[model samples]
Target: MLTTRHFLFFLTGLCCFTISLRAEPAQFEPEAPAAEPGLAFLLPTDQFLRQELDEPDDSDPLLPPPLEDSFSQVEPTPNPDTESLPDLKTLLRPRFDISAEWEPEADGVEMISSDLNLKLPLYPVFGPPPPFLTAGYSFTRINAPVQLDLPRDLHQFSLGVSWMRPLNERWLVRTMLSGVFATDFYNTGSMAWQFRGGMFAIYRPNEEWDLAFGALATGQEDIPVLPVIGATWRPSSSVKVNLMLPNPRISYLISESETRQQWAYVGGGMSGGNWAYNLRDGSPERLNYREWRLVVGWESMPPRTPGRFQSPGASYLIEAGYVFGRKFEREHQAADIKIDNSLLLHSGIRF
Candidate 1:
């Protein structure tokens, strides 16, 4: 089963790899800089163990002291004995994020959504979850004219769990499960089971690139089954391309003297998930809602505080975007109805 993210990352990597293979490879810049933990704000929301997956909060990491060591040698120099390697579970830690998005009514329709995610590295109450476990909750609501449209409240709540583990030094696995609860009436034959699952084996060829392939699937009717093949690359300290995928961003680090560890990037990705709701004063058929998003945003950490890894993480963000290619599809309404493009305005905290 492929989630939206599975497809996003998959397509992103495939496109980038194809282009790179065709073009001559340039000398990589200085063994690719460590993925800065401060940029956790830039991660894709749909990823499992997000911050940890890319750059876990490691107080002390046992990585090769020199970049060349990772590529040239199977074992690093300082650690002649591989048995003494630090366990990744110790480097992993709990992480959480919360954010909300809203769009003004367009064509007499409006939508709002919010999400909260927590990665429980400390799940055993005494120790950590062997690999890693995460829990997420999402709430969405779409308001429309009751008189003109059916009295269907297109609201949904989703609870999901994600499990991740490093299969080996070069491969990591991520899987997810989500359940849907809707605020609409349905018959015994109707049920809204928005279950989605994905499995990806990701490989880090070097410090700057991550390659992965898998499959993403969903039980929802609107979203399609996606075969995953993706790539994540950072050509330089400030430029990153996720390929033909979601959450691609280009950032500029502001002067350090600015008090806040300030940085800004403009990014965008696919938004909206399938929702099932019954029609009123009509047939027993239901409808599915979906949309695509394009956003430009700026986010910065709280000033004069410990960084995201050390203390509770917090960031200020403001984003303006547009949602288009919106549609509603179902059996009775077999034909998808196009919704007008709407302006998206969002102000939220990521903590």
Candidate 2:
């Protein structure tokens, strides 16, 4: 068995990254927190899943972290402290995203889509590497009113586990593995599905800068495996510049009140996913979707309630972005639908 080493080596050299490239909203858009195979800018293996392990807000956050990042179609970055998290039993969060203005329909194929990601974090697990560890379960759904896909919907359910270990004081190793099961849009699903995930080594040489590189794999035919990298630099306490263009965001902390905190940033990343569809005549089929985005958003977090499991009150966001590279492909079937660029609006809340 070649294992995944050769694939990893091949991908290691593919650094021709793009923020204009889109992603497949496979299972979680992060809150990208998408480590979701991240690249997702939270953008992850679900990735580049908004690339969360936290719903980066690509399913991730640029200013503040959102709660979604489970199976968002785009990879985004959610701003996480990345330092230490207060001990908690679990965290329950959810998020949703919608894209519109798809133009030049494909043969009467309307081009608007929406997706939702519900993130469940099972905290309190012990770690052999990092000080703490946890497992994650994310549920996601994507919808589009279009042709070539039967049953009117697509679904993804995933289970994952992650370990964050620190090497010395400046290096960190974050590893994650997730298994995803998706319905064929028209049928009751079976265990036969897909898998995607990543493992990263992060260097936090100091608070002002961080660097990372890793391997991300999505067991899709068109892209079976690939590599990923990320770098974050904070010039000031409130300003962040990201070198990971695919899902990069320049963020600023606008204000901080005991009961409220606000942040904002702009970034972009890849988005897309693979889903099984049915032919118009009701036959089994599969299709792949890929796209890109430029996102600008603001997020606010209300005070945290007093408790280990208390709510962070509520966090909300308003976002606007332009999306491009909308393509529906099934190359072997010679069905390549090029979707027009569109503008999208987003609103989300974490309870």
Candidate 3:
């Protein structure tokens, strides 16, 4: 049987906890950072978004504060130049991205999915700013055995807002709220709609470490609610250790230049979705698909430039991994079919 014990061990080894010395003192730049969407504790999509927001940038103007008191102590510094608000162009800029994934038939099951996402920045009347508005749509095609009797096509549409704010020099809070319609088109009533949300509190004592705690409402049958706890440790300029649930990864910088950089990472996580649909005779049913994956992948993207309001022109990612613990379940039924381990391949692009 597949379990979470191995996943826990894998997270522990990613960070050995040895790098203790603090880096040189640095200044904190005040700007309207990007918003993080989705539940950090449950979905791979949200995890990927967090990774993008945290990626090292060539023009990053802020660095860890001077070490004082204990490793856990961080004092806020005042920035006198942050009184002005962002311009209209920066507030209205939008980002667009698209991705596709495929998995070959294994034990009579094959799957393909694609996603499109858009994010729009918002202007604040005063103070900092409000959350960004996000919209997304995804479609999945499943090829299964005749005996399974499942829907061939599934769809999910979501709209939400995400925001993050600093509580002090050492703490940041992030939250997301979204409503999703997950169904097979045949089911178009309230049965197909569900709401999910997440809130996370992050502690950053320095530039090298970030500790986080939060909770998530997944709106799924198996695990409806979950606690989010994790930490990010950067021991050097080129390595990052992310010890988090659902998805955990360790990345190493491979190559870099003024324009673009590349990195390779090995990681494992959970992926799947839950949907509602109608049978031929008008009976309502819920389908849940779940899978665990371990993979190595490489990603390429342009370095972030300060005051660059728009999104990156383009980015690319490709990965392949071993997939196991795959299963399909039908609610209010006795059918719980297990799928054999298979190979997974995925590629994505953003612009």
Output candidate 2 Cα RMSD.
13.8
| Model 2 TM | 0.65
Better structure of 1 and 3 per lDDT: 3
Each candidate: how many clashes? 8, 103, 0
Best candidate (score: lDDT): 3
Put down candidate 2 lDDT per residue, 165-245, tens digits, no spaces.
Answer: 444545556666667666554644442277766777766555466677787677677777666577777677567677764
By TM-score, the best candidate is: 3
For each candidate, C-alpha RMSD in Å? 12.3, 13.8, 10.7
TM per candidate: 0.66, 0.65, 0.77
Q: Which candidate would rank higher by TM-score, 1 or 3?
A: 3
lDDT of 2 at 52: 42
* Comparing 1 and 2 on TM-score, the stronger one: 1
* Weakest ten-residue segment in model 2 by summed lDDT: 13-22
Q: Whole-model lDDT for model 2 versus the true structure?
A: 0.49
Tens digits of per-residue lDDT, candidate 3, 21-86, equal 122211222232211111222344432233223321211112232121125444544444333444
Compared with the true structure, all predictions reach lDDT values of 0.49, 0.49, 0.62
The alpha-carbon lDDT assigned to residue 239 of candidate 1 equals 55
